[model samples]
Target: MKDTFKHKGLRQQLVNILITKGIRDEKVLNAIGKVPRHLFMDSSFLDHAYQDKAFPIAADQTISQPFTVAFQTELLQVNKTDKVLEIGTGSGYQTAVLCELGVHVYSIERQQELFRKTSNFLPKLGYRAKKLIFGDGYKGLKDEAPFDGIIVTAGAPFVPKPLLSQLKIGGRLVIPVGDAVQVMTLFIRKGAKEFEQHEFGEFRFVPLLEDKN
Candidate 1:
């Protein structure tokens, strides 16, 4: 529960590394710097928390690498008060980042274990999603439709149609699409029935699963 000065120093170093790696969004970098990533992982991997790497969490999910989180977040172009739907709430680290940027976040997790753990953990860290539900990410929270941005933290075989339909016009959806190797993809809703797609390079993520207990 402690965020020591040492941790703060390490996070600053990480922010510098991100800068060198081409993450120019200062808001995103500041969010990365402020979040105590060590709190998001098992204590066994605490030493690696400040590194720009991903490590295993419970329920066969991996916390996304810091650069990957920043990249997806940057693509969203999140503005303060924007309503964002996060498809996977694996570690709650990415959710905290969005919260830091002052966005209203509704995140869904398919794994009940993770959903419960994160929902309980985040508020303790003073980072809370507006809503965190145990449900299918593919469904995109239909009742909470028209998000200003949608971010899928796991790799999707294809873009979920519900997610696209749930976007407000001019909203962005950032996701990684593929089975084994994913291409970081972005979709901007330009108009009703109109979207603009862009592809960044490849990344590997745990698959975004469907139904779960």
Candidate 2:
């Protein structure tokens, strides 16, 4: 599957960069290595795909850097059969990473343009996510509640309570929480009223807004 991308050198560079930045999970590294980052961006930005930097995609959204994507995925520690929910699907880049990790993914994106584009892009790229929702992700997907894992790509002022509610008892959610400055946080649902919070370092992401666009 990795060979089909035919960018072995680029993948290696990304892997090396990730390793240097402390992403140690081999599974996460492999998934990052396998997904084609270039396919998610415009041709003009193709050259920047391999770099460990976020670049603008359509609709004013930026594809997250390889480092941050791998960092969050590693924190989730997703298992092969787990059902995962992704809060934002900007370029379908993170969705591809989740798919590569072998999760049955349900991703939500509120941008109508990005949603429309990725609906076609993901299938054509042979990446598979179980479902994609074009609605306010702040509400989470109630019908698909209790996911094994949940990832929020955009930063939220407060961790959306409904998203926390949708997590399975033992599920883990990775999100960046803050208003102006954000810190990547992990919430592990231990019970209905109990959760463990683990804080990672800071990160900058687009503000998670409730846009039904």
Candidate 3:
């Protein structure tokens, strides 16, 4: 599996589509352009990798649609060296995007199979999160509390309290909340107990489950 000219071209086209969809963050678009999305998918689905659509990955998970990845990351406003807590490592595509932004990512994945596979796979692609924990995302990484940003890749019925508690003052948390259809939600920590909330339209994602398997 190589990131050839064709793959790079396809990624540029994907970035163009995201721009049309209103993903204006240059950093996000650049990361999307640089990362090889095709390599994240199963070989059989390689041809469809850059289509801006979500495709199934191992462990009953789906690599997020390219736009969704860009959209969430844009909301994060990541800065270099930011400590980011990523819930639901999933296909590790989102994790890779964050890493490309030069943030120190701590991603939590509940499914053991996906966790093990992604933990090994990302480093091979030269993308490494600070810590890829096989634990419940709902609990977050308490010892690493006060992260600069937190992103939940799955749709949660409600925002997890622990996640909010772990955000640093002035940090952002990007997540989708709902069951059938999710509303992209953002929480910005203003102070010790103050948060500013915003919602951005709707999206569909796999449910954010609790506990670890």
TM-score of each: 0.99, 0.96, 0.98
Residue pairs with colliding backbones in model 2 are: 112-213
Pitting candidate 2 against candidate 3, the one with the higher lDDT is 3
- For model 3, residues 126-190, the per-residue Cα lDDT tens digits are 99899999988889999988899999999999999999999999999999999999999999999
Model 2, 1-213: lDDT tens per residue?
A: 133444768888889989998999999999898888888888898777899999998888899989999999999989997999999999999999999989999999989899999998999889979999898989999998889999999989999999999999999999999988899999999999899999998999998878644
Residue range with the least summed lDDT across 10 consecutive positions in model 3: 204-213
Which segments of model 3 are wrong by more than 4 Å?
Answer: none
Model 2 worst lDDT run, 10 consecutive residues: 1-10
Ranking by lDDT: 1, 3, 2
What is the Cα-based lDDT of residue 58 in candidate 1?
98
Which parts of model 1 have CA positions greater than 4 angstroms off? none
Arranged by TM-score with the best first, the candidates are 1, 3, 2
Clashing pairs in 3: none
Global lDDT of model 2: 0.91
